[model samples]
Target: MSTIPTATRRRVLEALGVGTAALAGCASAPGAKEQATEAETTPQEPAMNAAQQTDVDRIAADPTAIPDPIDRSEPKTVSVEMTTKEQVAEIEPGVTYTYMTFGDQIPGPMIRVRRGDTVELTITNEEGNSMPHNIDLHAVRGPGGGAEASMVTPGQTKTFRFKATYPGAFIYHCAVPNLDMHISSGMFGMILVEPKEGLPEVDHEFYFGQHELYTTGDTGEKGHHDFDMEAMAAEEPTYVLMNGEKYAITPDRHGSPSMSVGDTARVYFVTGGPNLDSSFHPIGSVWDEVWQQGSIAGPPNKYVQTTPVKPGSCAIATLHAEVPGPIKLVDHALSRVARKGTMAIINREGAANPDVFEPEA
Candidate 1:
């Protein structure tokens, strides 16, 4: 296995205009060196057959598993609990990788709260885990976004309190020294802080998290792959995934989110990129209402085709299932879907409207 030198990685990040703080953080962290050394020493194993597979279950979070909307009109105290989990899982049919996650799934769990609500957040690092972990919620207005107050080592748990003063869909992620690697490994999620007046109702709601994974093996190579920090610094990834697995949210795999024709659905998407930006687009439909950058304070942009969601940011968009068929969700970069494995589906089940989309035989 080959690994880029620390100096080379630094140069790559610097050339890409990555902030000095990130560069400094990576430089100061010992994990980078340790990982590089491990990558060099580790032997690449041959592809494993289906019969040899042990871990077949995916780690991707369910898009439909979202918290209920806040019903209370007044502020209240909310408690959020998350546990750090590290496990080996399949990225695709035969490809496997070790993922560090929050609550056993990629992007973790969706946290919902209303503006002015006081949240008592607690995080527990699973026993026997190898590393320390902490969370920095974009919704919080405090030191390290509450990360400083919630750092936990293996077998330890910590709690912190913060008030959601503003309303927005925010990305919450691990904020350790090697945060980029951690975020890419699936330590990120979304928190929807509803505005006082609240958002308009939709027929359905879905949550998704987008992040890149840098592995020692090439895309789709079978067997276990180790994290490649060098590729991350160079802004290249082996796989760009939605949720956690490759094409996990498609009808053929875990099954996509289902909806009826003419129904409206809102998608809460958080990009934990640690590098790339997502040109979020829904094929066969346009975003009927787009809360750009996850800001729900003002009116949404209507009829938007696509929106840019930067790393460590969130976006909320509503889609109207106008015509019946599969609606492919992609980053619009194309290659990520074609090569790196990043695509999702929305299955709209109902009669097709020929007026909106006609096919002549």
Candidate 2:
């Protein structure tokens, strides 16, 4: 007769939610009223009764369906033309350091591809005494990236192929035993497997690699660039460079290496770490976009301006190349770049030697 107490009603409803079938026909019994009173005060809804009134209700259900984005059988191929190209870098202003490189550039060239692409690379080893140099692409699905089976012996050539899965900005380096030696000797590169979910394309992409060579050190003079075997034995790389040339990134302030102002340049950067990551940055330029975690998904993070590069990481961005002077690409490990590394100049419009492009600093 009196309204059921809210507390009791709530308790009843809570228990009813979990199969109260035992009450069955007895639901209408004397105590049944008390049971209903308890449920009435429940905060929870009693949908059980509504279903009970519908015995012939066709069961309704919702289905969740998601489609697979890739087909395993038809992977795309990405091809690389591995030819040795010679170029120089700047370790300091007014000075040049020469080194060997893949396709004339250290960190090699930028291998870009769309999602689900199969890459076929043609690697050519020439002129260098380094034997059996090969590329093992991290993006590859096959064993050893097929590098173990495919390598271009000195003055030799070879071809290999692989399917690119799990898009990201990945590294392509030598998998040789003295792996560090191969890489440090200028055998490293970057590969971009664009994700199925695409990303924004940038204006210019410049590619470069950060690596250390265990060459004999130089004891000629503290300030002189000479090879000192003792220092080298200490695992101290005598020289450091970007793109095969020493000091290629350092600007020539006193009438030396230079870059132009209008050249839209992007350095496709990578660090074939000798167990160290590179925090590469342009002293004057901002990174317009970045490719990280091996560049797997999303539009490239834009207007990044500054980004930290772990070993094996790379990116594509625009920089004011030919800026009427020199631009420095330092490790941000600043000291290393100062102590080692190389530089180069981008001369523009018969500027003779644009030297360092110091912007009113």
Candidate 3:
């Protein structure tokens, strides 16, 4: 797969004013001073110690970690457990940020259940965390989407029951007063309510979450960065990431999802953007089928190049791996991929299909 050259990426960053010293004069931006005033009153994550800073964990959720498709015909009660964690993790090499998450990963774990099934979800706020948290699932029909009943303070656990009355992919996120801050910090994920008949079978299925992070420092700065409320209010993100980190799902980072040529793969993508929308696209390939807006109830659109996934929404798309190479998953808003670090990869390995794609020899 082709990518923007390093020099071009640097120029793009410079043009966007996201350089290493970008935030130095941000105080002069319009309304920035007022946003800074508001930020001073916002609760902030505590600073990490030397060990916490050095021993940071990867916040990127594994794309391959998702529940199997439901096969049973009858709907049953399903129990889901999630723990809220505040962790200091690297967004890129040398740049660490504290992420507030569900189940210790960005876009938390994917919750899968059949439509009409009763879901009993329990959320536990880790005792060591500094802030309170709660879950607001779009699949839930009650007030606050279960957020009101599931608010948990440190060391507390709360449970709420809801029937999965609909068949669609939904976003779940923290519903605190500073929700945007929490979500931008990684407190979100997807819940898939499969139709009773079940979804189309594919050789491989992957889960991914997209979110933007607003930090006080410049992009790629070496240090533990703090959340930038002013930047978030301006919708100017330091990084537009997939799975919590810069290109976290690529071969160079945590490792890309793999599939064999000729195999079919379905991707469940959730956009937890507290601000921006995504022009979700797969480079080097087209979506063979797309469940627009994650609505599996309707017929899928065919052979689309890209689909828009709004914040707090989800989309499901399938791809046919016809050639042997890497297919890139990007926002299609090229600057984000080139400068802000948003990308994932699906590596297909097998004999090249010249009929499908033949590069100049």
Please give, for residues 1-361, the per-residue lDDT of candidate 2 as tens digits.
5654333354457667733465466787889888888878776632121111221111100001111223343446646687753223332332223334566555666677766777778877775544667778877788788777566677887887777767777788877666665566566777766566554443333445677654322311122132223333455565555654454433322222333545555455677765566666666555555655445465566666566766555655556544444455666767676676533333333243336554455
Instruction: For residues 1-361, write the lDDT of model 1, one tens digit per residue.
Output: 7866444455567789897777557755768888767877997444333322434387999999999988889999999999998887888876777789989898899999999999999899999789999999999899999999989999999988999999999999999999999999999999999998888888999998899999766788776677888789888898999999999899778988899998999999999999999999998888998999999888999999989999989999999887889889899999999998889999999996888888773
How many pairs of residues collide in each model?
0, 67, 0
Tens-place lDDT digits, model 3, residues 218-308: 7776677878777788898999999999999998889998999989999999999999999999998999999988999999999999999
Supply the TM-score for candidate 3: 0.86
Clashing pairs in 1: none
Name the better of 2 and 3 by TM-score.
3
Candidate 3 — which residues are off by over 4 angstroms? 1-56
The 10 consecutive residues of candidate 1 with the worst lDDT sum are 47-56
Cα lDDT of candidate 3 equals: 0.90
TM-score, cand. 2 vs. native: 0.58
Greater-lDDT candidate between 1 and 2: 1
Measured on C-alpha atoms, candidate 2 has an lDDT of 0.54
